[model samples]
Target: MAKLHLIKLSVGTETIESLRQWQAGKQTQTADGLPRHVTRMWPKRADELLDGGSIFWVFQGMVQCRQRLLRFDEVIGQDGIRRCAFVLDPAIIPTTNALKRPFQGWRYLQPADAPADLPAHRQTEDELPASLSAALADIGVL
Candidate 1:
């Protein structure tokens, strides 16, 4: 059983290249004296998420890239609150553009509902401007 993992559209990440740099820089946050990307509220279906799930990042009103789930850890923050640390594989796999309404926090994504990974040959879209990409998508040219 796979589960969905979601991240808010990054405020600073406008392009995939920028996201790659951001992600490279995002990996070293300290959690419980160790490095991890932890979020509040441990997911109830951690097993399913760890089984075979990717954290889908929402970008520019659409679901974009993903990082594979590796493991989960419990961390106690400086405020003495416990959070779920999602240890993820560093690879970011791009996905087909799929529109999504804005929402708070991470949400579970069922496998059937997850966007398909973009094909390797269809990588040219990354070179286009966001608006041009959107226009091409709207015109079925992407």
Candidate 2:
């Protein structure tokens, strides 16, 4: 099974607006798409999840990629309240060696089940981390 990682990333003002617009669009498209419970839980959970020393997974396509640490912040939302946001720093890296297969889509893995002692270097959202390189070495990702 794919490991999950929670990443702390700051959503820019533009990104937040875009997300809101996307959510609005989705709401119009299908009533049963995203549940209200999930939406309500996201903010509070995000606050807790972004606490210090959190780890998250990174992904390229459908495959697991690297991991990152979460750095929390508060940004002004459209409503003008300082709200939670996160910043990502690499915990792992994705590379040809790390991935047993090539990626075909664009999505990231959540940080929850990522391996501890993951290589610290060579991990990046756009590049592989050293830890991931070592992990891949074991699995022949190279």
Candidate 3:
């Protein structure tokens, strides 16, 4: 089966660097030292998600980067409610910028609909502002 992926808005994040800094904090990591994002719902297709899927992060209104989905862990909140934790690989791979509208929670992304990883030469290029990138994408210049 083709691997599945998730796309989530990185709220309050303006740039990829800021997202990196936020995830770098110790509080954002699990006890095992891997970065994880806690969410309210566990994916019903967990089996496919574990088959080399990744979580693509949207900064501003553009999909910017991705991290491999290592696994999902069950987490209990202080209120004793169960939640899902998305265990992520530490490497944040940059991707070709793609615009996405605002949405709640996460959405499943088919591989065909996902943006390609940035080419090595472009990966290190300075990031364009989100609006500019989105505009370029709209014009098919990105």
Candidate 4:
């Protein structure tokens, strides 16, 4: 059986609303988009990652991203130890150039760990393309 998991992706504060609107507009543009009863919800896992100082990286292809656990600091009170947190990194965070539709940005997701439906690429996690690494490093996250 496939392991079910939740994935989280980073989004800009300013672009979130527009993204939401774009998602809604998808139904009108395509016959099959998001379900009518399925409304996108906030309090997303991504928000928690941001609040905890964790960074999300966008990769290419489904199953490309991996899940890892880390600990982050959260202020409980005057004195206390930091807490641990879990977050999902989208396999690929589509960049402007890589996207078919134009928008701020979008995260590629595979509902759960059902093996990525996208094409497969044989590349080790540490063997990222130089361009991608540079882009990530430029953002001070790599």
Top of the candidates by TM-score: 3
lDDT by residue (21-120, candidate 1, tens digit) is: 7656645444433324667878888888888887887777777677788888888879999988877676778877666677877888888888788898
- Give the per-residue lDDT digits (tens) of candidate 4, residues 33-96: 3211111332245433343222222333212233321222232323554332232222232222
Ranked candidates (TM-score, high to low): 3, 1, 2, 4
Our model 4 lands, by Cα RMSD against the true structure, at 16.8
Which consecutive 10 residues in model 3 have the weakest lDDT in total?
Answer: 11-20
* Candidate 1: stretches off by over 4 Å: 1-8, 26-36, 135-142
Pairs clashing in candidate 3?
none
lDDT of 3: 0.90
| lDDT (Cα, tens digit) per residue for candidate 2, span 26-118 | 422223343111111133344444444343222321133333335444445566666433334422233233222333222233444333342
TM-score of model number 2: 0.31
Backbone clash total for model 3 is 0
Better of 3 and 4 by TM-score: 3
Q: What is the C-alpha RMSD of each candidate to the true structure, in Å?
A: 3.3, 12.4, 1.2, 16.8
Off by over 4 Å in 4: 10-63, 68-84, 87-121, 125-142
Model 4 lDDT, residue 30, Cα: 24
Over the full model, what C-alpha lDDT does candidate 4 score relative to the true structure?
Answer: 0.31
Per-residue alpha-carbon lDDT of model 3 for 1-142, expressed as tens digits? 3489999999867888988888889978999999989999999999898898999999878898999999999999999999999999999899988889999999999988888999888888999977889999888887
Q: Which prediction has more favorable lDDT, 2 or 3?
A: 3
**Runs with alpha carbons beyond 4 Å of true place in candidate 2:** 1-57, 62-70, 78-83, 90-112, 116-142
